[model samples]
Target: MKPLDTAILLAGVPLASPVTLLSGCVGFCEDLARMEGFDFSAVGAIFLKGTTLQARQGNRPPRVVETQGGMLNAIGLQNPGARHVVDHILPTIQHLPTRFFANIAGSTVAEYGEVARIFDDSPVDGIEINISCPNVKEGGAAFGSDPKVAAHVVETVKRVTSKPVITKLSPNVTDITRVAQAVIDAGTDAISAINTLMGMAIDLEKRRPVLGNGQGGLSGPAIKPVALLQVWRIHQIAGPRGIPIVGQGGITTARDAMEFMVAGATAIGLGTALFRNPLGAREVLDGMVAWGQRLGVANFHEIRGTLNQP
Candidate 1:
């Protein structure tokens, strides 16, 4: 049998590996790249911290709280603004071995467009529309919570950048497929299923929320089931359309990554797993190759969307 081929084309961009270091966890991929055992070429791509039109101070103190099987974070989309990232930061790491994507977020539809427009002129390989951010113009309700608002955000960003647009959906909605269908109609090149679920942690002594922002996004092993279902459902909508899906949420092992691939994720996201093991990407890649060899599968495509449903 032939050796397993992990390489793939994600929304027209060539990816040497299916493992994509997710946004916010890898942080520009600088420090991690400089680590002793880190291999930039081992992963397909890395998404930078969420960037907005302007710099943000982020949320209050105690932004993260650890839970039983996961963690809650309310970082509040803190970043150095879009222009600064495109002008200063992109120049530094654009030459890295792996592709880089700008995860853009904003409080309004226009802000997302402006930010995407900025990155559009840069060397970033692609753009990820982070609709999980609150729409300040609409009384701070999350943009991903409403199908129409999410579609509007995607449409606005799609108009500004020619790069592949991957819309990240939030799991806090009643029906995630509605938002997926809306963005698909709005012309997104790909989809990132199941952004962190909304959750809160309470302080026993203080008698208040553990996170400073009152509520935070939950991620880790606890959310794997939710993430899988979201990816499967989104794939049902995107599969026939030829739109790729980047599956994420609480993947820590190679088996976990394989599960995502079989569920219809063309590319697997490594997020919270990085916090526990910075070198998890390489480990997962090796394990995937071994699993493929054992199963006599030569590539990820064979494993993708092969779930046997009753």
Candidate 2:
């Protein structure tokens, strides 16, 4: 297992801890950065919500549905738009201590590149191409499920900017590693495995889908076991190629972070847990650091995949 450390380095940025915040709104991201003074420093980085060139209203009401494994969301990448993010959000963190990560989504290659260009000059540390979102019209799954389309999105965004690109992949596919390899081939700097599992719930009384969209991405503790499996599997794939892995999915405690590190994750992201408790990120980081110290683990990287060595 990897040893614990008080700080994690991401794309060369010194994050006080390996716990990163996953969000979708500019205002929330800025506020999170501002909260660092109160020990928000453990935050490895922040992943902005899905973005587009034009503002979107997202899906209709009842977009969130609960399932046996996790909750599904049909947020649809609602945001104030790319230009607004640059104008309004970039300034809020001009002097913040951590790295800024942007999550982007698009219906076409041009839209993806355009949004990538918008963040090209900002203080953001990296970009996460959201290839896992289900396509609204295309019969195929999200771009990430289709290697050809996934590679194209990675290559398209790579053409516009030099910032480290993190391609977020979905677990709904048959072969996640294959999808991951395709994006890596196109030049993404890192990979975030297992976005949210696909799931749905129904309203018994209404005899309709619980969520307005019928299906939503499932997340939380229910999926942690699967998330760990995916992270461990992807770590194996990335090892031979020297690519770093950002572990995410159902992380709610420090032990959870340790599990991923032992399985082979460079850093980690805290998702749905953030909504249940804003302080959840800080708490988990603190616990992980303590556990590492207790185990005499000095650096998390050391624990990365230590359990799998021959």
Top model number, lDDT = 1
Evaluated at residue 265, the lDDT of candidate 1 is 94
Candidate 2: stretches off by over 4 Å: 1-4, 25-27, 30-38, 134-140
Weakest 10 consecutive residues of candidate 2 by summed lDDT: 23-32
Q: Assess each prediction's global lDDT (C-alpha) against the native.
A: 0.91, 0.79
Question: Distance from true position, residue 296, model 1, in Å?
Answer: 1.5
TM-score of each: 0.98, 0.92
Q: How many backbone clashes does candidate 1 have?
A: 0
Q: Encode model 2's per-residue lDDT on 188-279: one tens digit a residue.
A: 88888668887878788989888887777888889999999898888777867777788888888889888988887888888877767777
RMSD of every prediction: 1.0, 2.7
lDDT of 1: 0.91
Candidate 1 RMSD to the real structure: 1.0
TM accuracy, model 2: 0.92
